[model samples]
Target: MALPKPGTPVRGSTTGRPIMALLDLLGRRWVLRILWELREETLTFRELRERCDAMSPTVLNQRLRELREADIVVLEEPYGYALSKQGRQLLEALMPLQRWSEQWQKKLAAKADQES
Candidate 1:
């Protein structure tokens, strides 16, 4: 299939297949969380799920597959999942987002306290 150029209409899937497909992949259960768990250290699948508060095994496996396919994660020598170099780069790009989330979470908690 010819890929649509930027600003051109995407021909498949109502919301435009490319963006929707990306979002769909990202939106899978525990996908981002799995990557987040690997931010600092690699972990076996079992360990990853434990860190993720016991995410479903099936879902975790699926996310791992997708992440590996996207080259954002790799199964290393010890056979544990670790963020790929590309994934580390992506994480660096999201450092600002972490700061924003910290601020946003505090604000949200303060708002909740005020409401209570």
Candidate 2:
């Protein structure tokens, strides 16, 4: 499958706005998990698969291929798979969202506890 890119049609938006393209790619099953796993360091295919709860090899391979095509992941010599420069930047951009999500979760949990 062709990876989503700006200036071309993407799943959610015909115009393929940059953010839409990114979301289209990230929306695929296991895509975010793969990126998250690679956030810290490289991992061999086996190690990554294990960390992902032994996901089907076919899906993992497909996701990795897609990530590489998007320039978000790269395979280094003897180091397995790691995030590329752009990927790191992407993670940096997401840090704020992560913090927000944690805060949101806390609020939700507190509300639930109060209800209980």
Candidate 3:
């Protein structure tokens, strides 16, 4: 789908269509994890990799590029990726989803145990 203009109200989106684009970006492999890792503090490329359980450097680099292009991530003076203001806002917005995910995880685990 053609992306909505920046700052345009994302049609068909309560949060707006722009948010769908956001979700699409975050849904990519390791993208959400990268954001989660950046939540506490900014880290150098190597540091990000280490905290990411040593994800392949190639994959990490690619995600960073996509995030930067989307203005959800920025490379700081010291050469570490940090969330842009918009990115921080997006992360904060997802807090409720994070709680929901934890609950979902527990529920699935319980179901698996029962099945076993």
Worst 10 residues of 2 by lDDT: 27-36
Badly placed stretches (over 4 Å) of model 3 are: 1-16, 108-116
Q: Candidates' lDDT values, in order?
A: 0.78, 0.94, 0.82
Q: Which ten residues in a row have the lowest lDDT in candidate 1?
A: 1-10
Task: Please give the distance, in angstroms, between residue 80's alpha carbon in candidate 2 and its true position after superposition.
Answer: 0.1
lDDT of 2 by residue, 1-116 (tens): 78899989999899989999999999899998888999998999999999999999999999999999999999997989999999999988988989999999999999999999
Descending-lDDT candidate ranking = 2, 3, 1
Q: Report the lDDT tens digits of candidate 3 across residue range 15-45.
A: 5465565666666789899988998788999
- Displacement of the residue 67 alpha carbon in candidate 2, Å: 0.5
Q: TM-score of the candidate numbered 3?
A: 0.75
Deviating ranges (above 4 Å) for candidate 2: none
lDDT of 1 by residue, 12-68 (tens): 445556565545555566777887899999899889999999978987887787788
- Model 1, position 73, has a per-residue lDDT of 91
Give me the candidate number with maximum lDDT. Answer: 2
State how far residue 79 of model 3 sits from its true place (Å): 4.9
RMSD in Å for all candidates: 4.7, 0.9, 4.2
